[model samples]
Target chain A: MSLLQQLRLGFRSLMLHKLRSALAVLGILIGVTAVIWLVAMGEGVSYQAQQQIKDLGATSIIIRSIKPSEESSRDVGSRFGISYGLLRDDYERIVTNVPTISRAVPMREISREVRHREYAIDGQAIGCTPDYFGMNRLTIARGRAISEVDMKGYANVVVLAWEAARKLFPIEDPLGRAVQIGTEFYVVVGIAAERTAAAAIGGSLDARQYDRDVYIPLSTFRARIGDRVFTLRAGTTQLETVELTQITAVVEDMKEVDATADIIRSLLQRYHKSVDYAVVVPKELLEQAETMRAMFNVLLLLIAGISLLVGGIGIMNIMLATVTERTREIGIRRALGATKGEIVRQFLCETVVLAGTGGLLGVAFGFLCGPTVNGVRMAVGAFLPEVWSALPPNIRNLEPRLAPWSIIAAFAISVGVGILFGIYPARRAASMDPIEALRHE
Target chain B: MNELQPTVDREIVASIVGVSKVYKLGGHTVRALDNVSIDFRQGDFVAIMGSSGSGKSTLLNLLGCLDRPDSGQYILAGRDVAAMDDETLSRIRGRYLGFIFQSYNLIQQLSVVENIEVPLSYQRPPLPGGRERCLKLAELVGLSGRLGHRPTELSGGQQQRVAIARALVNNPHVILADEPTGNLDTATSHEIMDLLDALNRAGRTIVMVTHENDIAERARRIVRLRDGRIDTISEVRPALPVVSGSIALERL
Candidate 1:
């Protein structure tokens, strides 16, 4: 028979039992959709993490000081109780000595209660410089940030975190208004835009959250609040000395950070007795982020693979049942001068048709799932722009990536699965005794 | 008993020396055919007669190359068909053997014209004269009126007619009929018998295996088989003065 006629016959045979065919195709459909969606989700998450890490400045290196333990302090510099940790000279020395050092910004964080009239909020008070604005990706909502002149002249000005500003003064313009901090009132120079928290990349540093932070110049902080400071407690006359815990730096040339950090380490080694100094390169975090992405991809592929397997099983099931139903038909064809090869070809054609239809439908379902899922998320997100604003740069700009070769591959594999499952039944039909088949009801 | 199977050789035109077919059911073995043997030359018209279980169908299958005897040599047109392998048997059946069964085993999906093409398909190059051959066969079998009708769409008699045309398509040396009129009424049976008679007169060899004595009487020679053995073979002389058919004697 001609190929066209064979196809027509196959289609009609399938249509004869509509429910059975649909059930078979459904198995394939579910499997295919699962594969596409799971892979997409895993890829989406890993991609989001990578960009977040890259935004941390892939080329940048960070150096923070670590305090020495009691054991290390007992020998050498520790014998005289020469304190270990970030010395003021370490910062000044790197700036002056490192050849590739393009620009450097130092930051110190402290917790203080800022009060404006009746409202007060406890937040992190950060000591930073002019370059900190551009390095930390801080955008101004209103007013201006501390400039080079402000850091040089030790200006008593501060920048309010978006959430900090909202909590302390909900309806009022906090810009240019003075807020009390540790008995010293500072004017709000600018309001920083809120940014999404950095995802955990590796064991290097904790995630940086911009929600509850305040920025101030390092020079101004050193002048107003010296290194040796103490706070008094109620009823006990207890004193708490503020120890500088973290010094976040942004180097101008990202490539120089590792070598620069090593130099600073050796310089600090001569004067220090503690292991309290930890130099971190944000690029390491980027590497960890990529590793995570690779792991996620493998996981997604596994999930997709399971679904495809199920779909193949479904095709196998359907084809098996179909062979039984068409037993008599097959016998009749054989009797009517059709060879065993012809019979095989006819049934194989039927399976190809089933797979072709199911594969196309599955791909379409998978393609459409992204939009439908995203639409629901967007609908719910209407109530909160803050959450939507933190959406990763990749997903915020919607794009439906259609891998053409994958579509074709999926189509071909579906059909192949059908045929593989179809063999036993086709052979059964072909091997039947023609005389007995004629006598069969 | 000595006639268990026919003697087999390379040159015998058609031989059934001594063939015995036994069917085993549980511990009991029933003999379907009992030492039957017979011989006939090419282009000879012969009929087999017996009651149910008398092995008429078994004998017919042996003649048509559809089944092998338990013990017998069946030589057909100079070939030892009984000794041939299944593939050779199938090929031989395709090239030379033709069968007309009682049920008229025409495929329901195929039209009358397509049904006639079944045996012809087995031809190596598929003997040419595609449409013209189909038309001639249809006209020969009086199926010109319903060539396009499927088997179910046609009457039992009409379907049998298509089966006959299919049998004749390959232009084989021998034609085997197993109760070809078993399902047809008396008139239709007689009509089909007349058609067979006309073809036989035109030099086509026909073998009819039937229980009906009346059907046996139509043939030129009669062979009676019982207990898987041939009991008698008698030349039949017709009692009636025959009338000619309206259809012309056309060579396919």
Candidate 2:
């Protein structure tokens, strides 16, 4: 039989049993859709992570001094709370000597209970220069944060975070409010805007609570508060004193972060013997995010492959049944001098048609899946308004990143699956005893 | 159309030597053809006649190269069909031997003209003017006006006639017909039998398998099979002519 005639006849058979053919193709449709939709979602999540890391300043190197845990002999539950990590001279050396580094901002934070008449809130007292706000994206909502003038004179002004303002004075303006920190009192000079919570970039850093923070000049903290400040907890008997908690260094560009970090690591090698300091490069975090993205896609593909496997089995089953139903036809075609290869090709063509039809429909369905997911999320979000505050990443639906190559790959793989499973049934039909088949009632 | 070319010597159309066919069904061995040998010459109208289980069909299949015997050589035309590959055997069948199945085996999806054009599809370099060839074959089979009709639309005899045209489309050396008239009524059977006879008169070799005595009588020679063996070979007698009476003049 000619190939065209065989395909035409196969099409007729499929058309004759429209519902069965449709059901058979639905399996493949769902399989292909799953592959596209799941892979697209994985890509979307990975892309979002990379963007967030970029926003965190990809060139920035973070050096957090983890207070040594070996000081358990002196303290109870917490580590040593004092001047630890690399010396102050090392930060000066990094800024002056390393031409690779653009700027270095050293910071120290202390948690102290602050009171205002009846309302008292416990929050972190952040000690850093004015340049720290631009580096960490802390925008002032009411008044300006401490500038170079305040850092030079060592002033006693403070900035209240958004959460502190709402907690201390819910109905009054917090611009000129006075809050007492331990035995000292400082007037509120500014209110910071809300910032995104830092959820640890790959377990290298701790989860950050950006809401409860009060910014003060580092020079003022050193002169007035001194290095050994204490906080007596309500339940605990000991005091918590900390000089500096973190130091963020900004390198010139992406290429310099590695060399500057290497230089700083060697410099800090002699300062601290313990493994207390954690230096983080957002560049490395970005690379790790990309690797995680690839792994996620592979995992999704494997899950999608199961559906494809089921689709392949369905094709095999239908082809086998078709061979049985067309026994006499096979015999007649054989008698008419069709080669066994021709018979195999005829059956394979029929299977390929089923798979191709399914693949096309699946691509269409997968394209619409993005909108469908967003619609469902929006409907649920409407019922619960409190969840709106949790809607930065959730506000936008997962962008379906349709890689052109993925579509081609998916369709090609589906056809390959079809042919691979189709071969057995085709061979069975071709190998039938012509005489026996002809005599079949 | 010019009749089979008369060569210097007539070729042996088929030669079977010590051919045997055995079958195993439900673990019980059945000998379909046993220790049988036969020679068929070109231009010979041969009929294989036997009752059921006599292995007539088996012998027919072996001769057509559709089945290989267990322990014998089958040479059809000039090739050893028993040793030929399936692909080669199919090609040889398409080129050298035409087939007519008991069910007519006309592809129901095809028109009468397309049915006749099937065998011609496998012809080397293709037959020239396919439409013309198809129309001529259709006219020869008395289906010229019904060329556009599908097989289901044709009568049983007409369908068989179309099957006959399809078999000869490639101009094969022999036609192996497996009970071509089995599905037809008495009148239609005779019509098909007459068509086979006319092809035989045109010098095309034919081999038919049938148990009907009247049907077998139309062939020039008959080979009777019994118990998977050839029982006898007999010549068919021509019909006796009726005597003519003296003419009476009725003119005034």
- The DockQ values of the predictions, listed in order, are 0.18, 0.34
lDDT of 1 by residue, B127-220 (tens): 7776678779899899998888989998888889898888888777778887899999999999999999878766566888888889988987
TM-score against truth, every candidate: 0.68, 0.75
Clashes of each: 19, 0
A28-66: candidate 1 lDDT, tens digit per residue: 676666656655665566665666676677656566645
- Encode model 2's per-residue lDDT on A153-172: one tens digit a residue: 88888888899888987878
- Model 1, stretches more than 4 Å misplaced? A2-4, A57-150, A155-198, A201-318, A378-410, B1-101, B104-155, B158-179, B187-209, B213-224, B227-252
Model 1 misses residue A197 by how many Å?
6.3
Evaluate all candidate structures by whole-model CA lDDT and list the values in order.
0.70, 0.78
Best by TM-score: 2
